[model samples]
Target: MRRTFKWGFIGVMVLIVGLFLDYTLPQHDVVRITDTYNRVTPLGSLNRLFYASPDAGTKPGTAAPDIRFIAAVRPNGKVIVYRNEDTGWIWPPFFKFNSSNLQAEASAMKSTADAPRWVMVTNYGWRIPFLSTYPNAIGIRAVSGPDVKVFPWLNIFILVVLALIVVFFWRMWVRFRERTLDPLIAGGQERWDRTEARAENAAADVKSWWRRIIRRGR
Candidate 1:
């Protein structure tokens, strides 16, 4: 039972970490730009975390910011929307500050369905229509065609570094248990044994004294 619980806890932790990395890491989408426009959208508590902050210098008001949007169509004829915004100095650490320039580039790349101009968009975040959250676009560039092979070197490097960090910490934890925690536990067990021995000796003495008094009374 203890082994099962330990394995279950580790599995849960691994799943949470995997999901966090999947959401935070940058991803690529190759699509044809259909349109680019700005909309005054109101952000609520539910979807606010997915969008950029007003302090990012992309939008001004907190209640309802004028958000720039890029609409694109995938090769399979499905549509996907991306929000253009600066990532500011914090969070995700994309350091994106040229949202306007990116909007312009996306606008220029806009093409019709007949003559599509494929582009690779590097972005992070998820688009949940139910919650009205859209993926934030970080960078965009023209590609040869819809099937252009785009290698994710940055993601590969980050994953490797993260794996190394996890391994290093795991080793540190094991060493700490062996060098520090195990010894403390052993010392505690020794102290407990001594305490039990003393308690037993005191009870034995009390019983002997009582017996002697009873004999004197008789």
Candidate 2:
């Protein structure tokens, strides 16, 4: 039962970390821009957190009055949609505030099927259709072709730094337990064990004395 709980907790932690990374880490997609448009997105209780917070860029809203979107199609025949918004010095720290410019660029980059101009879109977040969530596009750049290689250097550096920070804190915690908490616990345990040993020895001595007296009487 203990092992099962330990594994279950670890699984939960892993899933949380995976989702966090998926939501925060920037991803690149090579695709041909199909269209750019805006719509009044209604924010329900479930999907509201996925959208930008009010005062981040849009007006104060539970339902965003206007939300920009970019539509694209990959070479492999999959359609991907990205929402453009200002993160505005909040969580994830993208600080993006140029949604209008991005929309214009996306509109300009729209291409035909025969003469497709593949562009790499830098974005973060998830597209959950059920909750009506879309990834936020932070950047766009023209690539040579659809097959251009895009390396995620920013993600690599951030992950490495985060790993180092975790290792540093973990080592500190282990050292603290060893130097402070462990010794206190060990000292208490040793005192208890000594007291038990003395009690056992005294009990045996009393038994021996009682037995000798009984033997004399016999």
Candidate 3:
């Protein structure tokens, strides 16, 4: 039972971390830009976490708002839609304020199915059809073709820095417990042991005194 609980707790932490990274880290998709347009997308409780802030690119006081979208076709003939919106100076900190400009660029790069012009779309987030949430595109660029190698040096560096930070704090915590908390615990145990010894000795002395009194009376 304890083992099961331990594994379950670790699994939960892993899942949370995975979702966080998947939402924050930028992913590159090579696809043909089919079209770009704006639509009034309705926000809901279930998928609100995946979209931009309520005030950003929103209808200014309504549940539904107009958002820019980039519709593209992958090399394998798969459709991928992206939401272009401002990150608005928070959270992942993309700080994008040019959703319209991005839409214009996407429109300019729109291509046909026969002779496809491949482009790389840089985005972050997941496409959940059930929740009507799409990946938010931050940037896009024209590529030579669909087969391009984009090495993620930025992601690698960010992950390395985060790992270092975790290690530094973890080591600091371990040293603190060993040097400060552990000694205090040991001292407390010693004091308790001394108190018990004194109590036993006092009881023994009281019993001897009582025996002496009994003998004298007899």
Candidate 4:
């Protein structure tokens, strides 16, 4: 039972970590830019987390924000729409404040089905139609073709550094346990043993005195 519980806990932890990495890590998609446009879309509470905040100059509590979108078709004829917004000083740490410029770039690269201009889009997020959420496009560039390979060297380096950091902290924690925590725990056990011994001795002396008093009376 204990072994099953331990394995279950480890599986849960691994799943959580895998999902976190999948959501945060940058991914590349080679698609043909079909259209680029802006729309005044209202953000609901459920889907608002996927979108970026309004520009820094916008007033707070603004309703029905205008968001830019870039629509593209993958090589396999799958449609993927990306919301181009400025992730200004927020999560994912992209620091992308040039949404307007990116929109212009995407517009220039737009192509039709006959002569599709395959472009590589670097983005991080998931598109959930149920929640009305779209992936946030970080940057876009023209590629040779849809079959062009994209090596995620940045993601590889990031994962390596993260692994090293985890290893370093794990080693540090083990060293701390050996150097500080282990001795303190041993010392506590020794003190507890001494206290128990003293308690037993006092109880034995009291019983012996009571028996002597009873014998003398007899």
Question: TM-score of each candidate?
Answer: 0.89, 0.85, 0.84, 0.86
Stretches off by above 4 angstroms in model 3 are 1-8, 54-60, 192-218
State model 2's lDDT: 0.90
> How much is the lDDT of residue 190 in candidate 2?
100
lDDT of 4 by residue, 1-218 (tens): 99999999999998998888888798999999999998999888898778888865666576798899999999999999999988888888889889889999999999999988999999988989999888889999988888998888999998999899999999999999999999999999999999999999999999999999999999
The digit string of per-residue lDDT tens for model 1 on 1-218 reads 99999999999999999888887899999999999999988888888888876535444644688889999999999999999988888788999888989999999999998888999999998889998888899999999989987788999999999999989999999999999999999999999999999999999999999999999999
Off by over 4 Å in 2: 54-59, 191-218
lDDT of 3 by residue, 44-163 (tens): 889988888643555456548777899999999999999998888777888887888889999999999988999999999999899999999999899999899699998898889989
Relative to the true structure, how large is the alpha-carbon lDDT of every model? 0.90, 0.90, 0.90, 0.91
In candidate 1, position 172 carries an lDDT of: 100
TM-score of 2: 0.85
lDDT string for model 2 (6-92, tens) is 999999998999899879999999999999999888778899788775435456744446889999999898999999988887888
Each prediction's number of clashing residue pairs: 0, 0, 0, 0
lDDT of 3 at 136: 90
The model with the greatest TM-score is 1
Model 4, position 34: C-alpha lDDT score: 94
Ranking by TM-score: 1, 4, 2, 3
For model 4 the local lDDT of residue 60 reads 52
